[model samples]
Target: MGDVVRAPWDAYFATGFDTCSEVLRGRNWLAPDFAWQERQADTERWEAVATQEMTKTLSRLNAPEHTCQRRSLGNLFDRSTVQRLTPQVEEHVTRLLDELADKLRWGEADFVSTVSEQLPISTIGSWLGIPPEDYPHILEITHNQVHAQELLPTKEQLAVSAEATVQLRAYFTEMVRRRRERPGNDVLTGWIHTWDAREPDRERADEILYRLTMFVTIASLETTATLLSAMVELLLREPGQWKWLAEHPGHIDSAVDEVLRYDPPIHINTRIAAEDTVLAGVPIAKDSMVHVLYGAANHDPRRNENPDTFDIRRTGTHLTFGGGVHYCLGAALARMEARTLLTQLLKRFPTLRTVSPAVYAPRLVFRRVTSLGVAV
Candidate 1:
């Protein structure tokens, strides 16, 4: 396929590194926010509760709103914060590895369920002061919630996503209320105070805090789990790289970046043209939607040498966390989690091996690996 092509469904697909990067970083491109959704012909699709809830998130907002909200929470994932959280990440990794060791003694253990899924929820939940008892429910709802984010969700999937969105809202609303009743020195409580102080309207503050809590939980869970599992799976698949990493533990950072570039958790991102634009000599009209394929672009030979090869030594850049104003706020935290997990995991189980190939769910935009069995 050419770098830019029109899909049969009328959306433009930007698959090359240059084209995708331009669309992502260009000022003329915008996320499909609420206003854009309202302008679409499919009223019923845009009217779904899940769709509406998603458009309100930090990722979907444009310009001034996005700028303001992002600035408010900017320090949450800064280098110092992530560095301060490293010890806690190490503690969680150690605990999870100990549990995995017990399971390995019996037979092959599912790394996905036992370690990958647990670490992220444990870390973020503790940070947000959420009780450990609630993680299982959060994980379930988060998984169901992403169906609506799929490239082409079915009617049934949309309904499931809508229901999940409702459950999440109710859960976070209660959590925010409890935090107000019994304040703690946690991220959620801090946000509550910040929002309340800035906005005199109590109801509006609560609403913003509720959405922030829900978004942080949903954003951190599945995607980080996928990253953790993918790192382990890829390393084990290439025994030499696995052994090399075990010895040269200092290269963990590079290894993490390589894994992100080779197999990102999110493959596609959608953006709309704010005005008439020409991409690679092709004219795109205003309000046209373009699906930027990060996965395809990451493998573009023009951007990196031996693009298909997973070489941790190569210093390569990727669109995994996106670009421009909508760059991922949790990038630093996610990197810290992966690095800590990999370092501790290798130190504990250098002989770890994948007993079976990863089994992924039927997803296009988000890569969801349902199972990855491993033996130590």
Candidate 2:
């Protein structure tokens, strides 16, 4: 659905978990095309690695292995874990806000480049067992990996950009191996044991590993960073929402949701037609590349009243995280990070405000507030 991201379109076998949930009532899919791709082999090209190699990783959110992994790991995002991470999240947020306040004391600062990016990168890196010292590198790799359009730089060039990813995968592979030799407490260690125990097939473990790495690789930072930047942009553009959120404090969850609907982090995902079908009466042939216009779909008047309006108190859930069996595995973790970051940002800097007009790439596939200067 992008204006021009053709060669490197990279349509994920992704799902709008909620979208499917809405249409199917917890039983079906939003589009038949999406359901077909859910079982396709293309996704296996990458996901196979995660499930096959990682041993413990369940590639499918609906699959039994994934269910077990989700039960174990998903608990990390539940109330107890969220409660546990709150203090640490706040402490980290305090450091960032203080850093921002310190810098703004001198002059204007690019908050998106400096602050928004830092929050998710740190949170995700910690979640993935990456060291603090390497977050900058992680950010660079994830950033380039997502934007590697193969336009100026061919797929080969894009692959070169993913050198860090290669290194990252190699590192994780070693971690998985070491854990097999001697276990530990981190999620990585847990994943290794799970992967080793499942032993679905000889190659299954590698596939699982790929899926697990890919799970956190592109989605983690891209979703969080883009959403955070969009939050700053919307809050700055709409003084009322910003003021309301600042005052209510508890409305941070609503603010996060509104931010997602107003300017979702991801805008487009494609689905291959399962067979001949119709989308809202439009004939769709089998194997057609059907673009899911999430941004437009989220704002469809049929779905939301005054779809364009940004109301933090808006009660309707949106399609930012997606729907169905393919729903984002990281949804809970992401929500917690957003709630924590926004809370800390608002609390520390009551005067928090963007100082520059945000810059966004016209790229339609992903909508990220690339840069937003701010004043504390």
Candidate 3:
């Protein structure tokens, strides 16, 4: 079969590395923005508050709107910001690892719960000035809300996502209101001030700020958690690699990149054809939807020498964080979190081993590992 093939569901699946790269980097390929949503025949699905809100997010918008919204938080995960935030990430990783060690002393510990899940939210929550008490609720709602973003969400999943979206909207709305009333030296408060200065209408400005805050917070949680967990899982599954990485801590960055290529947090990204186009000899009509399978592309033999093998020192690129315009804004932060956690984790527990095979949630787009039992 060729690189681009039509799936049973009617959408095209770009499986080859080159095909996926072309789709992502091409100017004609667009995110499923509001206009795309409006054009869809399934009016009811598009009308849901969750779907509507998702389309408005920076991830879903296109062209001028996406450019404008992204520009607002452009430098958020830049080199300087990540460098400034590294020490904090390290601090959290150290504390979480200590807690994990305590749990391991008693018995096998769930690394997903103790470390992977905690570090991302803790780092982002502190940065956004959200109270630590609220992290659990935010995590719960974010988990539910992400179901709506799946490649083929069922009725049940959409309902759950809608409910979660409502809760999230209310939660962020109130949080923005409070921050506006009592300005804090936090990222959210700073955004509120910036939007207030830009937009004349207070209500509109608040809405923009709330959406931005909700997206920023939600975007960082589950994906980064999955990255951290998968990184540990991959390393532990290979004892020699783990030992080598522990001995040579400088390879942690490459190790993290290898894990991302081997098992990315998100496997599929949907893009619509802006105009008539042909990919890998397959003619695609205007407005056609293409599902870029990142996992498949990453493992394509044409892309990597031995795609099945997890080699940390391999020098190649993966579309894990996507490519071009809609590439993940939190990529740098996520990498930093993974690198920091792995660096500290290897240093702390060189003999760490997996208690059993990892358990994963039933998700297509987002690869969520539900549990990873480990012992030191």
Candidate 4:
């Protein structure tokens, strides 16, 4: 409505919520696959997303408590909490790199299939207590969710999502139950303490946890992994960026941030207007769907200088993590993952190279790599 133009509320109101409308209205377009009290978690779509679902899911979990749940377990985002968690992340990145370096016996290897995917899933999965073997299955769910309409997930996709949800809920429910019985140092255990016995909607707590887990799992998966891969891919393509990063290692953090803006893992966000509104002087009626193009916003000449360049030194602001109350909560984790993974790549595989002919994610929403073959 202001700095960013949300979906066309009136257009959404006119066409109603559907695949196309969801893309257009961006605001509150519920996932049709799964049912939520608010935006129903689209089971089919979630299944197809592989990764984007994760990024989107996490965003929803951390969304305002008042709207979705009376209470949310977003303490994971507090600056103090992030600071405390950084060390563990650093260790994980280092260990992951060492593990990769150990496997580089062959002269050449596909880094994307090997190192890039391993870092985020391993780290994020460990945080949530999910076994590494489960990464592929969960990732598949995320892929399905994001690409549901295209893959046209038949009844089979819905069936898989349903069965998977049951399995996941059973797992989390048992996990939550055990944590409540005898809590541990894990975040889930801590979350159980605050999330226990959601009085008004006791029954909904299960769904809440389900959605919450989806949020953490899906959000971090795409942003962190994709961004990490994108960074390494770019360095290989430009080559010079590697020299700049190596010479000015101190700038890696800022470089990661710039890359996020220059080639954001997420390109557009869909929002459905809560009511009638006008955006960028364009009049929109109630319930219109709006597509917030963060990629475009980051490059908006009005807000930035030389928006086309990928200068790590460039600063100001961008909606890479979005804006306003519903902004991404795991931005810190995403940043940490990207920075750490990038650092590990430079150190362990200084001569890392991409296989080339990489493909852009076929979606109009989040921007990411569908396939990027790289060497280690």
* lDDT score at residue 54, model 2, on the 0-100 scale: 23
**TM-score of every candidate:** 0.98, 0.78, 0.98, 0.76
Mind giving the per-residue lDDT tens digits that candidate 4 earns over 18-112? 22222333453422212232353343344443323333343433334434442456546678876776777788778766665665665445555
Model with the higher lDDT, candidate 3 or 4: 3
lDDT of 4 at 335: 81
Candidate 3 Cα deviation (angstroms), residue 269: 0.7
Q: Mind giving the per-residue lDDT tens digits that candidate 3 earns over 120-199?
A: 99999999889999999999999999999988788899999999999999999999999878998778877877887788
Which window of ten consecutive residues has the lowest lDDT sum in model 2? 48-57
Ten contiguous residues minimizing lDDT sum, candidate 4: 12-21
Q: Best candidate per lDDT, number?
A: 1
- Output the TM-score of candidate 2: 0.78
Candidate 2: where is the Cα deviation over 4 Å?
1-76, 148-165, 200-207
Model 1, position 7, has a per-residue lDDT of 84
Cα lDDT listed for each candidate: 0.90, 0.61, 0.89, 0.59
Provide the lDDT at 16 for model 2.
36
Task: Write down the TM-score for model 1.
Answer: 0.98
Candidate 1 residue-wise lDDT, 1-376, digit = tens? 8788998886899989989989989999999998888888977777778988988888789988888777777567887788888898889999999999999999999999999999999999989988899999999999999998888888999999999999999999999999999998888877877887788999988988888888888998989999999999988887688889889988999999999999999999999999988987789999999999999999999998899998988798899998888878788889999999998888889889999999888899888889999997
Error of 4 at 189 (Å): 1.7
Evaluated against the true structure, the overall lDDT of model 2 is: 0.61
Q: How well is each residue in 241-322 modelled by candidate 2, as lDDT tens digits?
A: 6666778997888888888887888776544554565444345456555455566666766667888898888887677676
